[model samples]
Target: MTAALDVKGLTTRFETRAGHVTAVNDVSFAVQPGRIMGLVGESGSGKSVTGFSILGLIDAPGEVTAGAVLVDGVDLRQLSTEDLRKMRGRKVAMVFQDPMMTLNPVLRVGDQMTMAVRVHQPMSKSDALQHARKALEVVGIPSPAERLKAYPHQLSGGMRQRVAIAMALLHSPSVIIADEATTALDVSIQGQILAEVRELADETGAAIVWITHDLAVVSSLADDICVMYAGRIVERGTAEQVIGGPRHPYTQGLLDSIPARHEPGRKLPQIPGSTPQLSRLPEGCPFQPRCPRATDLCRTEPPLDVRDGQAVLCHHPLEGV
Candidate 1:
């Protein structure tokens, strides 16, 4: 089967008055149908930029300067504006972190969802609304029929996000890019959404790119994970492999820094130093400043090393299985 999404050598950069900032550098990953791939990273780690670049949504000073975002083997960058617009909701959809980004404050939920359907298919309002209601059901929303008449502000945050997710699923797009769509929700709500999303992807055979900074969430919700640091993926592997036996120092640091990993009273481990400014990144690994195992060899950028179904980018990765 063709991959649902394939991003190859993606490099997104921003040209600012100060200097050029590489937001996503040489990132490559593929999500097969029915799989969830977590794009995990810290703030300014370029995970979100990767999402925007894949959707051809970057604008103005920022651009996808390299690589291809392929949907079922077709490059999105090659599509014309009209074609791209048509392909967006029909082939690939984005679930933004903010539900408001997807919702129209003035529009009724039913109207917004029905419009999403009609935008890609010629369907009557009644038929489209049926689909919308079913979508809400799929996302576990209760009182779906009555809620359809409500406006965005009438619902709680979790309800609004579910509506956004329902809208994304209304088209059964081959791929969905969820950029921290559940981060703002409480832990229970976030877990519910994550579980529902993973189940939906499996049941519908839709690939999902779940971008967030929470390694714990990804560990439980994703099949595979790519750890990003300073605009580049420092590690990639099966969720269990990466989380349980992380090879790259940065990945290990991320795992260690999780609050749950430490004893209740002990200090939580954290990567030292703030995220570096992309425009002024050192000549070596972006995580070198905070990496405990950095060596002189790290002064030069390390190539992504692929071994035994894992990719590690570091001069001195952890050894011993």
Candidate 2:
């Protein structure tokens, strides 16, 4: 079966004053309908850039130089700007980290959502409003009819985010790229949203790419996990495989370093050093400088070693599974 969203060898770069910085290099992944693929990594790992690149949201200095971002077998990179713009909301939707990115402070929540679908389809205002109300209800928003008339600022943070998600669902798009959308919410609210989002995908049959730095969240919310380092995917496998037995050193470090993994009175283990700057990344593996498994072979780039369907970019992959 064809994937709902397929990204192949996606390379996005920015020309900075220092030099060219590749934010996403030859990254590849596929997400089928009703499936959620977690793009997990630290800040500046290029996960957010990957999401923006997929939606044609990259700005002037940043550009997607190579590879394809396909939505239901249609390559978005091959489309014209106007065509891409048209595809964004109807065929693909993005739930940005900040609710304000999706909500216009000046516009009433109802009006904004109504405009979202109306632009994609020639629907009457009343029909659009009805559609918006139904979407809000679908996302578990209460008193949807009254919520629509209020401005974004009138709603609480969680409410605003729910409104944003409801807007994304308004079009029933084939794909949704949620770039750290729940990171800012309180823990309880975040969990509520995550559960709701998973249910939403199941109900709508839409593929979702959830980009986040929180592994604990992904371990529970995602079916598959792609651990990114310095713009490249260093590990990819089923969520349980990656979380239970991480082959890549970077993946291991991430799991080991999370606070929840530490026992009482024990400090959370931290990965040595920090993520490398994209412009000055080492010639070999980007994580080699910080990897404990580095060797002479690591000075050169490591091929993605495939074992039992799991892939790890490391000269010496970890053992035990």
Candidate 3:
């Protein structure tokens, strides 16, 4: 089956005054229609950069140097700016970590939402407003009509996120990238938003890429999981395989760090050492410094090997079923 989104050998780099820094290195993944894939990693892990690269949103000093981003078989890099702009809001949408990134504080909520719909769609003002109102309602906002009239500042954080989501759904895009979209909301509100997003995917058959640092959130929402470290994906598989039977040391470290997985009195286990600076990455495995399983062979880069359905990049992957 054709994928809704297919990314192959993607590498993004930033040209800083210090030097060129590789942010996303040879990353590849696929998201099928109506399915949710979680891109999980810590801060500076290039997870967000990969999402931005797929959307062609990387700014100056940073660019997609290699690889193809195919949306429904069309290579996005081959499209012109005008074509990309048109494709973006209509075929693909991204929900950013900050609601402000989507919401304009000066603009009234109704106008913002309606404008999003009207941009890609040719509809009368009244019709667009109707569509926007319905979208707000779909995202579980109460009194959608009243909420539309209020400015973004008037709504709470959760409400603002809902509005952003409603805007993303305005055009019924085929793929949605949520970059830490629910990170700022309270647990209850986050759950509500996630549920709404899941329902929307099921109803519309939209593929969803949820990028987040929270493993627990991914475990709950994603059908598949990709674990990244230092711009590279070290482990990827079905959620059950990645989360239940993690093989890479980095993946194991993440699972061990989760408080709920530890004994009540024991301290949470953290991966030793910090993420290496991009320009000064280690000679072999990026995780070698912190991995207890690292051996002499680990000093040489390991290929991503497929075992069963899991893809793990580790010279000394934990041995077991």
Candidate 4:
């Protein structure tokens, strides 16, 4: 079967006062149906920008300069505005970090959900309403019928996010890009939302791109993981492979920084230096300035290589199995 989503040589750039700034540089990955791909990185690492570009949501001075975002073999970049707009919510949807981005404070929850369903599907108001209610039930919302009459402001943060997720699932889109969708919620709530998302993907065979800075979250939810640094994906592999035995120095630093994984009484390891601004990015490896294992060769750009099913871009990758 065709991959649910495939992104090839994806590059997003912005025309800023300082000149062209690349936010997503040649990032590529694929998510199979019923699978979740986790995009992990630090702030300014361009993980979120990659997702936005794939959804054709990049605006203003920023645009996807090169790449093919294929949803079930149909290239999204090649579609016209009208066609892309139609395809967006029907074949692919995005769950944003903030639920307010998806919900209208002035509208009732039922209206927002049903409207989304009707916009993508040919159905009567009654049918759409029924679908909306069922979606709410599917996402574990309590009193689904009563909640539909409430406005977004009336619901708690977690509830609003659940409603937003329900809206995304309204049409059963084949692909969903979740950009830090659970970051703002409490731990329990975040887990609940993830479980719901996982269930939805399994039930509908929808491919999901889960973008976040939390390695722990990715470790639990993703079948595969991609680690980004300074706009480029520095490492990609199965969740177990990347999380258990990261090859790139940056990836190792990330794994070390996790508080829970640190040895008792030991200070958590942090990758030194901040992420370089896009306008002033270093000449060679962006992570070289902070990498503990950096050498003279690391000062030159390293090619991304595939070894043992893991893709790594580093001059001196970790040796041994």
Candidates' TM-scores?
0.97, 0.97, 0.97, 0.97
Query: Once superposed on the true structure, which residue ranges of model 4 sit more than 4 Å away at CA?
Result: none
lDDT of 3 at 81: 97
Error of 2 at 305 (Å): 4.6
How well does candidate 1 score on lDDT at residue 50?
Answer: 95
lDDT by residue (1-321, candidate 1, tens digit) is 788899999999899998898899999999999999999998999999999999999998998899998999889999998999998998999999899999999999999999999999998999999999999999999989999999999999999999999999989999999999999999888878988998898899999999998887898899999999889888888898898899998888778887787889898887888889988887777777777888777768664465557888877878624
Worst 10-residue lDDT window, candidate 3 = 300-309
- Per model, state how many residue pairs clash: 0, 0, 0, 0
Candidate 2 residue 306 C-alpha distance from true site, Å: 3.3
Evaluated at residue 71, the lDDT of candidate 3 is 90
Model 3 alpha-carbon drift over 4 Å, by segment: 302-308, 319-321
- State residue 111's C-alpha deviation in candidate 1, in Å: 0.7
Q: Score each candidate by Cα lDDT.
A: 0.90, 0.90, 0.90, 0.90
lDDT of 4 by residue, 158-206 (tens): 9999998888888788899999999999999999999988888788899
Tens-place lDDT digits, model 2, residues 188-277: 999889989989988899999999998988999999999999999989998988998999988998888877777877988788888888
Q: For model 1, what is the C-alpha lDDT against the true structure?
A: 0.90
Q: Give the residue spans of candidate 2 off by over 4 A.
A: 302-308
